[model samples]
Target: MGPAQKPNVCRQLSRRALGFFSRDAGVVQRTNLGILRALVCQESTKFKNVWTTHSKSPIAYERGRIYFDNYRCCVSSVASEPRKLYEMPKCSKSEKIEDALLWECPVGEILPNPSDYKSSLIALTAHNWLFRISATTGKVLEKIYLASYCKFRYLSWDTPQEVIAVKSAQNKGSVLARQAGIQQPVLLYLAVFHVLPFSLIGILEINKKIFGNVTDATLSHGILIVMYSSGLVRLYSFQAITEQFMQQKLDLGCACRWGGTAGTVGEAPFGIPCNIKITDTPPLLFEVSSLENAFQIGGHPWHYIITPNKKKQKGVFHICALKDNSLNENLPTVTASGRVVKRTFNLLDDDPEQETFKIVDYEDELGLLSVVAVTQIDAEGKAHLDFHCNEYGTLLKSIPLVESWDVTYSHEVYFDRDLVLHIEQKPSRVFSCYVYQMVCDPGEEETTNRSCEKETNLNIILNSDNHSSDC
Candidate 1:
């Protein structure tokens, strides 16, 4: 086999159809389906309407709260007057507004699955009935007391999926159940966004550059409450869809007891991905975690790689731990790479607080990147991610995180290598760039005693910084 072409041994690099997805040079696994769903659900619904009964037609017509099912927003109404669903007299086809009611949501309960993000919230309506319904799964999950004259709403303001939802209480009556596990069969309300706190919107708009990609609130299958203040935003994520929806519903009289006056009605309803086309087979996924602000919070972002392969490993997610007090470095040693990137923070002799620390991103070549984080789930099974930039911090690199593109309806696979290997910058170039991901498994070290030498064949792979505790 001379220097001739051979049979392709790797996945073919995509040869796009010229004007494919996003206009940008990068990619966009476009999921028009999701966008379509959003168009129909999130934006079509009137901000204050939540009824679709024939009887409510007169009122709906008055409120500008109606649309053709075709508009098919990903969110649906919560609860309304009984005659409301039937109040509106059926109109002729010519009178339709929204486009596709893909499939009418069955009469049932919506169970939410609160991911790490607080995209959804549920509330009760007037008359003490389970009026407001919002969740990821619009299908029936549990049963509610028909006698409960309370209504609920899901808020969506700070999310990407549908909205940052919050549950509210309309009329008065029995407060929400706080039992360990109660079931309520319900309907799924996809997106909702009540009035959002000015603080949040202010923070986002002010720091758009860094948080351009920060987690936006979205409609989720779970219950979440976002606490954004004091530079910390805490999310109370519920495991089950109905876990906490009822826990935070408002009191009677519509006087919001949650905290603020921010509240809104349904946006859209979620749909089952067209089961017809999607195969039961799953796509390869990668899971990785990186800090929002590694070297700089609103600074240069980071990048990871997912090579074409099986495991779908993830590249390094570099993170830096910065504390209020600077670190005092030990006498720094110049590595074989000719550059001196220190590890141990040395302190100035006289003043302990005023110590020497690395001014990350000070060099022209070294820009800011992502960061590593450690989440220690508390005894209550609450995983508290260290969002602080103080004290000792761990810079971790994880692998195998997966993200889907709702913009593109196509499903694909992603695989990356576990970050741990590095390429030693040789005398080859003046400023040789060494690219690699590092794996830091501190818990496994004492028992495994694994040496980098045993893991690699490249002499450059086993450099000094590639030690068990360092890189």
Candidate 2:
């Protein structure tokens, strides 16, 4: 059979989960053959609306159509669809690719750069490479390759720092290694790179053996907060990391052990840039930094410490804001140096099913806070989503989600100050995006606004050609 005739599990699972698969064995084989025939007949690949918002206007990629809101299109005067706006790397026959079977389209995010020239500066990531592309002229500004076989995580564009932080790890072949009882090496690496000119500023091989494997990483202020598998959390200075590389003290090949026991780097804990172990609890998931308060010493940022409500507060998130002052050596106990806020989230009063809920995404604007919480689907396969005020803990809207036609929490929710976008992948391998415009009450000072209007809806379909198969 040809490469296009392969039986893919992703497509098969999507079909089976949606109950679109045929039961007859002969019919299924014939259907697969028909799909392969269609793949062979196609000449070129076409991508549907891959969109990103800029200010109030949302730009549809590939087609280059812009939508101001749900009612009107930006350049609606033209009769036909807009032409392709950007160009991406294409595969050639002469190229001997290492990961021919396992590949994904580069996921792009529009960076928030306050510049006149950068109207289209976007960060794109594939398997183990990051690309800086210009959406205006379809030009690739810079490309950096991480490792041959690795999975990416903790990817964020830090606007203030003007750098993009990405965490990668060695993907030991199959993703089912742990389930198959195969031991894989603990290899997690964090790389911070320049966004504009696209240079590799700093690279650090996280010491998984000493600090345990990294569960997640986040960028707050100029600090890189890393959480490990053992539930131990540490902080490192982003400025210091790039400075080391700029001064030629650390190389790309050198593995820096920044957070071991005392004297690991021949410096006192206070002398080191960021050498604080904030937590020892194993299952705590680190969230974003909530508030920043300035005092006599300096301004310190407080981040949310999130733990699943599995114990005492079931079906709730035991979230608390904590300020870590472990950088000061005068503080004897690092964990005790943390100042935690007493607030927690138990939004629902009568959730008897003990459904798992999480603060998937959130935004704060003009003394008003908004959060999107996703609860696990019930016995009828209905997922519950709550959008509300984080401070008041009052539910603004409870949206029931099903699999067939509506949006799913399986995807991430992207938001700005006034809009929230829900992008989900359908069983047909298409992406459906729903954008919501938020409106606040001008009369009420204490009560948070709960009214929201549907702004726009977009669907993205990937058309596969012979060169690049289904993405």
TM-score: which candidate is best? 2
The TM-scores of all predictions, comma-separated, are 0.18, 0.43
Off by over 4 Å in 1: 1-150, 155-166, 170-223, 228-231, 240-471
lDDT of 1 by residue, 390-466 (tens): 12222221221111112112111111111111111123221111112222333333223223322232222212234
lDDT for model 2, on a 0 to 1 scale? 0.39
What does candidate 2's lDDT look like per residue over 387-409, in tens digits? Answer: 45344444545544333223242
Could you tell me how far off, in angstroms, the CA of residue 445 lies in candidate 1 after the best superposition?
75
Q: Give the TM-score of candidate 1.
A: 0.18
Give every collision pair in model 2: none
Evaluated with lDDT, which candidate comes out highest? 2
